[model samples]
Target: MFPYRPMRGLDEGLYCVDGSFGRSPLGRRMTVLVLPSGRLAVHSAIRMEQADMAALDRLGPVGAIIVPNTLHKADAPWYAGRYPDATVLAPRKAVARLARRMRIDGTLEDDWPAELAAALDRLALGGVRMPEAAFCHRATRTLILTDLVFNLGVQFAGLSRLLLKLDDAYGRFGPTRLFRWVVLRNKAALLASLRELEQWDYDRIVMSHGDIVETGGKQLMRGAFASLGL
Candidate 1:
């Protein structure tokens, strides 16, 4: 079975499951948001054991499954199959790409549920070739992201460690050199989006890959982008 940790609470009404990307040492995380209505919205899904699925079910019915970005669609099909009734959402620019793998009910830019809208603020990251999106959970003051930045740290070893270090993401909470050179197409557009994001009141960050930033997220995010002269 694909290895994954059971659901664990993080903040009020928020939880996460730790997993990995295929055989890679790069860690992946699935964030679960429980709306005030008790419905659940899953972000960047990971295939989990039956018991863990059961645990998720016990929390609430899965009302929405978010793909977040084009590259993060690996296990979205699995989640779509398991929660057939759940609306599958992806970034507007990613709908076509994600549709090649699974059914996409709507785009994150539009068609978001009222319950989800009430809990989180969503934004599409512009000037990036990868079609990524980011969210801020207002109640928990947490920012949710996928691939815009990485925080791999020193948890990895050997090749994985060396590669991450070379990428400039091994021991830092910032974007990799490759991400800046290739994935980032227009610094100005991304900078505008980041400026808007700065207005959000978030202290913690929950990203799909690597460890979550428990505090000082706003500062770290600003610093990450500032390095790009954005």
Candidate 2:
């Protein structure tokens, strides 16, 4: 289990757990946000050992567990078994698939509790064939995204680095060309989602696959998505 690193600031009631994805040496991050009610909201959970779970227990009770997309549920079942009372939420497209692996309490399209809604709001990404949800933390001016934008940069090596570079993925704050080609289905919907993101007034971005964008995030995101020529 990796250690959870807390971000600074009251509004930034977030912590990150870093680990590698599958056989890939590139790091992946899971976000944990402490809600206003003193309960924790965990996103893209990565399985943790008993000692690490004890560490998280020191922060607060787990209230919500989120699997943001279809590909990110590797640890959901573990979390669900650990926190039976916590709400398990996933995108509509992923519920059926995830249900086959573990239990899902609801989809993001359903209504949210006021306490949960007050701290974070979920937006459905309109462009892709596969469903994905983006979250914004109102008080923190932070946007949480999964797979929408990657910043793998130079951390990769050998063939992975070479492949990411060939895909226009390495050393960047935008979506790789290969990602766009394989995952993107509707340019207009994606552009609309980008326009909606501009209105969130986000100053920072927390990405699942890369470095967090700490400043000027709105403009950077707009410019990044614009590379699609949508």
- On a 0 to 100 scale, what is the lDDT of residue 219 in model 1? 86
Worst 10 residues of 1 by lDDT: 221-230
**Off by more than 4 A, model 2:** 1-11, 228-230
Residue 16's lDDT within candidate 1 is: 96
- What stretches of model 1 exceed 4 Å from their correct place? none
Against the true structure, what is every candidate's RMSD? Answer: 1.2, 2.2
lDDT of each: 0.88, 0.81
The lDDT of model 1 is 0.88
Ten residues in sequence with the least summed lDDT for candidate 2: 1-10
Task: Supply every candidate's count of residue pairs whose N, Cα or C atoms clash at under 3 angstroms.
Answer: 0, 1
